[model samples]
Target: MTNPYTTAPMPPQPPLRPAPKWARKRYVLPALALAFFIGIGAGGASGDDAKTTAAKPKSASPRPTVTVTTTAEAREPEPAPTVTATKTVKVTATPAPDTGTVADDDSGADVYYANCSEAHAAGAAPVHRGEPGYASHLDRDNDGVGCDS
Candidate 1:
């Protein structure tokens, strides 16, 4: 029996070499050439060729213009003038005071309305001596009360 799969020996690679200076010279020459041309063009001076003359001040008129005047005849004196002055006065009115009834010293009335009005109206509580339902509710000394408390 013959072997169908067989391999041959490979050849060895060459050693690595260092880069030569001339390898970069190709790129450097073009850059230097561009910079030299740019310097030469930028260094040249440019100016306008047209010649300019100095501006002169304008001359004034030989003589100044003057206005003319005319005179009138004088007249005789007349009678002295009379003046009369009149003065006016202004008046303002004050408003009338209110005569309506005012609820002063309203402690008892306010207390009755706020705490006892509902109970009294519903008839749930009698107007007793110390209870809010009673007219005598504020009697702190309790002699069968009224605002005396």
Candidate 2:
């Protein structure tokens, strides 16, 4: 039988050569130009450029005293009411506040409909945060709930 799968011998590769000096020194000029430009960008005088005028010594000029005249309305804000001594008065329940009732286990929607629906149906909701009817449970974000359309 003839050997149809036989292959010829491959030729040997040539020896590696050393790179030329110029090839080895590839980016010298570009790097030097970059450094030169960087030095120029640092504001140091180079080449022919020099001060056009005299190099005067720095002298401290008194900052012009700014006499800011404020209008009468711009005076200090009125001081808030100050209490001399904080008497630690105990929190005593006087009477149940007359605010409309919210039944336990009732959802906020139910509470709103039961309490605020009538008031708000007429116009914009009058109940606001910190008002008697304003429940944080109803408006968790405290951005005013149940009537300020």
Candidate 3:
């Protein structure tokens, strides 16, 4: 609600002074960037000088070559052996007298083996009733099943 034409009082201000040219921050960043690039260029130049002097040329005529020689052999293989059937010759002669001294393995009581495995392997197991090798000792129960153990 004060008068509109009256101006307000201005605030107090401080005095200014320039910083030192060498200590200012605006030029420090560009100077550091220039020094980094110079160092990298100097390092790369020293490495390239060694590769140019190590190269050398070689001659093909100075190397040696070898040539081999072998004696030739005859290629005819050995003849294979032939197989022939032999013809048996029969000699005609007179007959001899009869003899009854031949031995028989299946004698009286020693007919079957001690176990069924031995009897079956010898073609003698499961002898039915009234068969050639059937007997009372083989069929214990007399039910017609012999050597069933």
Tens digits of per-residue lDDT, candidate 1, 104-145, equal: 743333234223334434443434564433454434456664
lDDT (0 to 1) per candidate? 0.51, 0.56, 0.62
lDDT of 3 by residue, 1-149 (tens): 97767797757787777887876767898889999999888767454565664454554676576989999998999889989965443322222233655435424223434444545665667867655455567777889967766
C-alpha positional error of residue 73 in candidate 2 after TM-score superposition, expressed in Å: 64
Candidate 1 Cα RMSD after full superposition onto the native fold (Å): 26.7
Show how many residue pairs clash in every candidate, following the order shown: 1, 1, 0
Return the top candidate by lDDT: 3
Supply the global lDDT for candidate 3. 0.62
RMSD to the hidden true structure, all candidates:
26.7, 19.8, 24.5
Each candidate's TM vs. the true structure?
Answer: 0.20, 0.21, 0.22
In terms of lDDT, which candidate is stronger, 1 or 3? 3
lDDT tens string, model 2, 1-149? Answer: 75768696657999999988898578787888899999878977654455533355577888878788876755788899987953332322234454687756443333232334444553325666644445555454567774544
Order the candidates by lDDT, highest first: 3, 2, 1
